[model samples]
Target chain A: MSELFDPLLAPYDERRRAELVAAYMAVEHAAAPVPEVRFPALREPALRRTVAAMLALSGRTLVRGADRDWTSGYHDDVAAALAADPACVLPVEDRAVLTLVLVHSVAIPRATGTLGEDTWLSPYPAAADELRRRSQLPVGELEAALRRLRTAGLVTQVKAGGDEAGGYVPGPQFHRLTPGARRRLQEELILAAGPDSPLAAAIRARRRSNEEAS
Target chain B: MSDEWAPGILARARARVTGAVSVPAAEPVPPGLAAVPDGPRTWLLPSWPDGATPAVLEQYELAPMPLDRSGQARRVLAAALRCCWANLDDAPWPGVPAPVPAVLDVYAGMTRGDAALAGRWATGELRRLADTGWLVLDEARGVVRTGPRTALWPHEALGPLRDLLRRMPGPSREALGDE
Candidate 1:
């Protein structure tokens, strides 16, 4: 049984172990990124590594947010591996709806130079009316898919307020994505939304070079 | 537990986050999940560390995943629990399956018999609960059972839920067609 113990976590007492586990749970379960200050256990390098190891035992990665917070999410490679099984992926309709929202909320604004952030979250929500107009799916199917997406935390509905008509924005789940996953999503969006752009060409070139190097 | 098992474990873990993953009952359970064995197949339900639940998001004024008509859905779930969870000593999952009408009857009892509109709403909520894995609705048999998620409810949290369930009135006799 002693041999089963992880050396990193073995240094901590039972109470301290519980605290670290609690911190991991807090980050893993929370809908949004948890502030680092809220859990002092996470600040210790050893405890942080232990938590990362624990997360890895189940195929998760601890995501360090730009805002000095923490969350847990799947690594891009693991997700890609899982994508080989069709049952593991989002349904095509759901994927289509999500792509449209991303294009409208993130890609379009970035292309027009109105959004400056490198992250997926955007203040500019994609309106339902516009999505309906743009989608090839029937209005009923689109509406149903949007409902499912909202419930799953992939897209959130914004109430109509002050100068802004209510619409949908990428939800808190985006915050759970690791940096690599976020960067890959950005590249995919660029490729899909502006395939003719020089940035897309550069992305294709980089992918080719990386493949050759590997 | 060699390094070779890592990819398969990771894929199952990722798949489980959004939906239930069924594995062979004879297989060893994955790291973060609790197995609910059902004959030859086992459903993997993700387990969280003690004292931490998704409700923690509310403490920071952050919304958890959105639920459509959450109140109605929860009430319907409660009704199902009241009907299926006959033995208070046992955990909620793998509870006795109850007929849909029986669950609906209990739901109606909870709401003081606003039967027509309430019945429709309850039916819709039941379907939604089934979709989200809160309840398993066997449409062909018209039976409902608690889903694996209920088993994840912390033991301490069950006390209050048990009390609330105890105080809840059972299915109305007239609603059950007994003169």
Candidate 2:
């Protein structure tokens, strides 16, 4: 088979290729899911080849996540470059959801007395409840808002043990943040929740141990 | 410079960075900071006394990585990475650690024995990758995410493999254990 041949995408005109690649490059706000194509059309080898060539030439990578659907991300180099100057351009709802996911990943465990990081997984119903409690948005809008977050790669849905519908957690893009950034965000959470916060207590405990050891 | 406790201190520091664990201070001084003759009582990371080389921090950047070609493990991990790649147009979330069991669950269709082996292989691979700065595993969080140094891996190297996977028939592709 030709090196350029991929069996999963349609033949790419230069305009179409540019549009797709440019779309990915412009996503400085958040990660976005790949646009879905009908299986039959995408199954054509010639089309897939054209698509793969476009992606490779443009330095894009095709990936999948908890949603079990294909998505795309810029190559690591491109992503790092874009991250240097990210803009908060996501829609307000998306921004809100992303913020909640970020805060939830770090704060939820402390709030619920779940010490483990895995408890960061917030179920859909729980998220809806939280949103309702905080923003007072109708419960009906919660699913759509969560879906928007998922599409933006800020939230991931994962199986909740034996639960059929699953739950939400910080998605792949959340992990892309620098450690300094994660630390800063956690610090903010602690401040808002007060020094008596569980996370604060955890930090204090570590510091105390260090002092005693010294 | 020749402190016997340097290794232990360094290990603790790395854990603190990668796993978010709170590490206790080393005797007389904490790791990652320069030794001060009359330093203040409070310990702070990223502070260095004048003329100190910050050896522990420097060593982290230059640590030697052991390359192990455990094919099954690589295949399993690569598959997981590919999934995340397909799902987002950015790097997988560094802050949120993915659950290992959930990752394995996606490939549960494999033969039970192969699936079991894949789990073991994945554990070994994750540890190796974590050591090499390709991945971070938060034991307390029970989650895994890409490491800070993930950009160091060759970006275009997986293109051909991804292309081949893309061309596989749907059912056959499904049989590969991708959800």
Candidate 3:
């Protein structure tokens, strides 16, 4: 919101460019049950392991793959990283934010594959929330952010559990996250799992345990 | 431009109405681009060529765009432009032969679709073509302009676009049905 913050972001913005940075992060990274991934369970190391296992598999794809599937790679990368609780501790860095936006936000890649244009997913509420939290900023501007993402086909009003019946999940509406939206989600994941990433080795160990158990 | 979804999204909507005319011999778009029954009639599509500037995508009724980062915006705009051009151009003109400027301008006003972020810079580069002519728009029929142009067609140019849909990339190319 403040012009001051905009200039400060320049350096961070420059560093986090490209759609397929974490090329190794893949959707098949964690073979654990998708439905089993719950927020409260995220606190448990065992469950976190399951998530981490999945995350490690994904990290490879993000860091290694030449061509990435926006839907599969993005969802896998973000889901695994979020489960590791990147937001809870380090709170998702700007680099990770860019990763999330790159893969998850179709608006950006959709722009790239066609027009040599790429509109990142920084405007996303989840993305913005994560950014504001890391920057230690407040969440005063809701209407403006929501309006832009919605129009850009990035963000949507997420109706959680109580908002629906027993069949519904307690998360944002699927919102038809496109290939472009994947870019946004991926950027966030990358930031959450940087070079000194705590989630990396942690996820590997979890996977090792799961493999041994199985 | 308005942020409300534009008309002519489907075959019927794009048909010959009292005022607007549809291209003749146009085929029904495959399900991926024109699954009329499944997808919403309204969509916030990104305008092409010039990137999806808030102003451009807004023109076609898409709104609530995130406002940050020129780099990201430019990339997304490029992708959206490709999607639109790929589908709308029934002929699929690839890389227009004329100079980038005049071709882009005519493409913009003609396609009535503005994803041409490149047009802002390349407008002056296009040369007037021998057969291409610019038709002034009256109230009913939007004007038609021909001659040297900018922008890529993805396919061969069928001369000056005879109809609104004619000037556009085929609907199947938009990847709408893929959704």
- Candidate number achieving the greatest DockQ relative to the actual structure: 1
State the lDDT at B116 in candidate 3.
Answer: 57
lDDT tens digits, residues B34-57, model 2? 222212222222221111221322
> Which is the leading candidate under TM-score?
1
Ranking by DockQ: 1, 3, 2
Q: Is candidate 2 or candidate 3 better by TM-score?
A: 2
**DockQ in order:** 0.40, 0.01, 0.02
The global Cα lDDT (0 to 1) of model 3 is: 0.29
Which regions of candidate 1 are displaced past 4 Å? A1-8, B1-5, B49-63, B109-117, B174-179
* Tens digit of per-residue lDDT, candidate 1, span B65-121: 556677877899999999888887888878888888888988887786558878888
Q: What is the interface RMSD of each candidate, in Å?
A: 4.9, 22.3, 21.2
Q: Write the per-residue lDDT of candidate 2 for residues A1-214, one digit (tens) a residue.
A: 1122223223556555433333322221123332233222123445444443444333344443234323344445443333443331455666566556556555766567664442323433235445557645566676667765664456776655664544567765653343344454566566555787787888778768988998
In the range A50-137, model 1's lDDT, one tens digit per residue, is 8887676666779888787888887666666667767677789999999999999888898799987578888899998889988899
Point out the worst 10-residue segment of candidate 3 chain A by lDDT: A17-26
Q: Write the per-residue lDDT of candidate 3 for residues A74-150, one digit (tens) a residue.
A: 23334333345432222233233333333334333343464233323222223443434543423443334343333
Pitting candidate 1 against candidate 3, the one with the higher DockQ is 1
Q: Which ten residues in a row have the lowest lDDT in candidate 2 chain A?
A: A1-10
Query: Of 1 and 2, which scores higher on DockQ?
Result: 1
